[model samples]
Target: MPCRGAAACSALAPTLPSARTVAAGGQPMQLPADPIEAARTWARHDPDPETRAELEALIARGAREELAERMAGTLRFGTAGLRGVVGAGSNRMNRAVVIRASCGLADWLIERGLAQRGPLVIGRDARLSSEALCRDAIAVFAAKGLEVRHVPEPCPTPAVAFAARACGAVAAVVVTASHNPPEYNGYKVYGPDHVQIVPPVDAEIAARIAAAPFADEVPRVDDPLAHPRVRPLEGLRERYLAALDGCLAPRPERPGLRVVYTAMHGVGAAYALAALERAGLGAIEPVREQIEPDGRFPTVRFPNPEEPEALALAHALAERTGADLVIANDPDADRLAVSVPGRTGGFEPLTGNQIGALLGDHLLEHASCDRPFVVRSIVSSPLLDRVAAAHGARSVATLTGFKWIWHAALELEGRGEGTFVFGYEEAIGFSVWSQVRDKDGISAAAVLAQLAERERRAGGSLRARLERLYRAHGVWVSVQHSVWRPGLEGRREIEQAMAQLAERRPETLGGAAVERVIDYREGAQARPSYLGRAELVELQLGESGRALVRPSGTEPKLKIYVDLCAPADGEIARIEREQRERARAVALELARFVGLEG
Candidate 1:
């Protein structure tokens, strides 16, 4: 059942020059998957020769393993759809997986009985595999007697979700890895309502995809460069922009905010700028180096806005231009982060938690809703709890993905259960409205711009608003400790950590004692409500809140989310000191416990 020898491996190996083998028991274990052949199989009928060659070379010399590793799994279709490295494996998001997933989605549409009245819309990002994945999806959907409307050019993923509802399609698919390395790509599914598919729907779709027969079993066409869908959705951008216009409330103050925008080599610039103007914030500038869509992602190592390094150019440009704010969107533009000047004349990147807290406060105070329910994920800060309580509104915590928030929102809207107001994840994702089921950076950018304008006119800055939230809610300071594991051994090493931590739970970290421990692995709450749950330990130090650990569903990283709520009179210095100490303690303990090399 296991690979025995390199000599035996070479027999069916795609004649690559070298093999990447690792030692097992004693023999060099060959990769169970062939990436070169996977790439070849993907590219044999590819329309673009350059793209095909690029994939071929990348896959040839053990590309199969890389692809298999990336595609070998299902790209993880949880509350959030697939987000991972793009390669030849089923685990990764290769064209084959996209085809399989799309076919399965088609079956779902047929079964749902929405196939005749509605079609499927396809959208994508600037990732290398995005275009191919989109094409693969289109072909599959078209063959299933469903109309497909493809976005003509690279665009933000939310637009596809938005267009699904606008075009009367039953569902939508966006091919984007979204904030992962350039080597990664992914697929996120949306229902006709333009929100993510939740619970039984996701399970049903995955099942249909798995049950799908061979690729050839479906319709096969030798044609390339042909439109598989009924036609490209040419006016998708305009429709989204127009709809965004209606979402904004009246401007609070000056029409110009002098903002610096960056798309992070993804497809968010045009729409984001439109949003700024729509919010009556004019003269917004974009960081040229990162605005345009570039698959190579030449500027940053990873296209995540959460990373300070990725926002370096934007921050620099903001300072030089003396802009009011700097906004950076992740590759797919589903998430947005901002940087504002601190006391020392330099910009500080606001953590996703900080931004979400600010937005939560603003929406709760200003939104014209009928008792809206605020939603956030487990990994996000509980600061929303404070804000929601102040408004007499109910708040719900779902698993750490927008899918959970989307489902909660849909449930409320469906039964007129409750008004869905604002939802956000700590990782730069926010759903300000239910217009789009998935997070929309463009829409949120507009909303944020409006909020900033209103606040500036009200005698405060976004920074001030955050500080106010800090003062009112006792500044819930949070930090993340992530342990990155590279290969299979690395993966095993990381997974082994759960057992280790469970066995040896820390009583104290940097002098902060654990008040309570929530073992989500035991399904501790006993409530039948929570979905996609995991082990969550509530480490309440002498301070506010502390989270022990959880495994990243999308990545091979062991995550420790730490939070400390400081007092109102607490100086920024005190908060920073504790954050540093707590972060150090967690990292020290994790590193010492995990026993990985420095």
Candidate 2:
């Protein structure tokens, strides 16, 4: 039967055909029996005219294969929430998908009896489709009889996170893709604890989303913001700034720190600048071309600050302005990147581990807590543990992801193990303050600025401070190697590689002996309960170094992290260079051992 309209299609459940079909060369294939029918149903119910037309065009062109791919499966909701290219299908990030996701989230909240606890906060970035999708989410929440609060403009993600915590909301959702490419958009859900939803909860939400009603069938309020259940999330930015004020300890202002900052065409300019000024950090030179919240990201090939090309303009500005420090925030402004003027003149970007070590040392040095503790992800450099121990503080390592990092910190603090001072991941994500459980690049930038200024006031530079710390704790050099394998075959290859490594552990890597192997999948009684199970393998090389192999949670790639250390008995630069080479060699060996040498 042909679907006539939106109401008619709501009753249709487009399920994958169970029967297999023959393909070219008599190969077996499992594809939808009638993808056109599925497309027609989806098109009828798609609220957005753009997406509806998109599906219609595909159907008109008899693009059966393409349609099947688009309808292969719904987007998977993991710990990171939903992220994908914006388009017109169940597998894409679109209005219909957002509506269904919102409805499911509403169902989960109601089932958990959290819907009436507080308002559900919604926020979005400057992505092209973010505003519309955010509205769709708001409408669904309002229609579900839940109180909705939303940020009025494009703002840093940390601002939304802080708003969720300060407002005592039951849950929050941010419509953003963070540092993902321009074509991507995402939905990030935060539990009442002000952190990303973790396991059991993530699984629960996924089940609800899978059982959600069709987009058109879900009740939605037109002009949701005007509804009595919805209200503007006011004073969010101001409150965020006020929280930043608490991140800094009282210290003399160093009015001479010249810094060049870039938002990478993100929404961080206003918030970062306000935080800097509030801290009495001298005027920061903003990259004019990339300061605004332009989703197109017209200035860079990639919006991620960790990418060298993304920070090229900032480096240029820093050189031209003779700035002492260069700081950048990824789009959505949840992660931070920094560079400092090298002894050789040009600005040298600091690795995430370097920054983490420096910031960990700085925070511990001035910590007010009698038992300050820091946390780092398993993939992050282990130097933080040394830094923590040097300061007589405890250091905890959790499974990869800021969600795990923050949750571990909270659990430890609750048990009176220590006061949570800071936590960071190897991906440039940092949480300088505990109030906002997730990473806050805006606050981190301010704290980094303070660290830079303090170093300058002491007649030293960040580089010099880093060297001093290295001298105290052996020099640690960390490097990351990634092997990209896209599509189903690639995913299988990644899984095979991990399985092989776990089965046949390498005796040595880069000529260094592998003393022990820790497979995270096999939970350890010695490990904290919150560490959880993850598909990660760690090869400990005694005092020389260590290597970690794991598949990326978000992208289709296998990642290997190598960390090597050397005594700072000689030239620090030479030791760092040599250790870095050793680390890269170890990473390459690990990749080759897993048959992922590409």
- Whose lDDT is greatest here? 2
lDDT by residue for model 1 over 19-55, one digit each (tens)? 2221111221122345555455555644445555666
The lDDT per prediction is 0.71, 0.83
How many backbone clashes does every candidate have? 22, 0
Q: In candidate 2, what are the lDDT values of residues 333-382, reduced to their tens digit?
A: 99999999877788888998989999888888877766788899999999
Regions of model 1 farther than 4 Å from truth: 1-75, 221-229, 413-417, 502-504, 528-532, 535-543, 590-598
Model 1 scores what on Cα lDDT? 0.71
RMSD in Å for model 1: 11.1
List the candidates' TM-scores in order. 0.85, 0.92
Regions more than 4 Å wrong, model 2: 1-40, 60-65, 251-254, 524-526
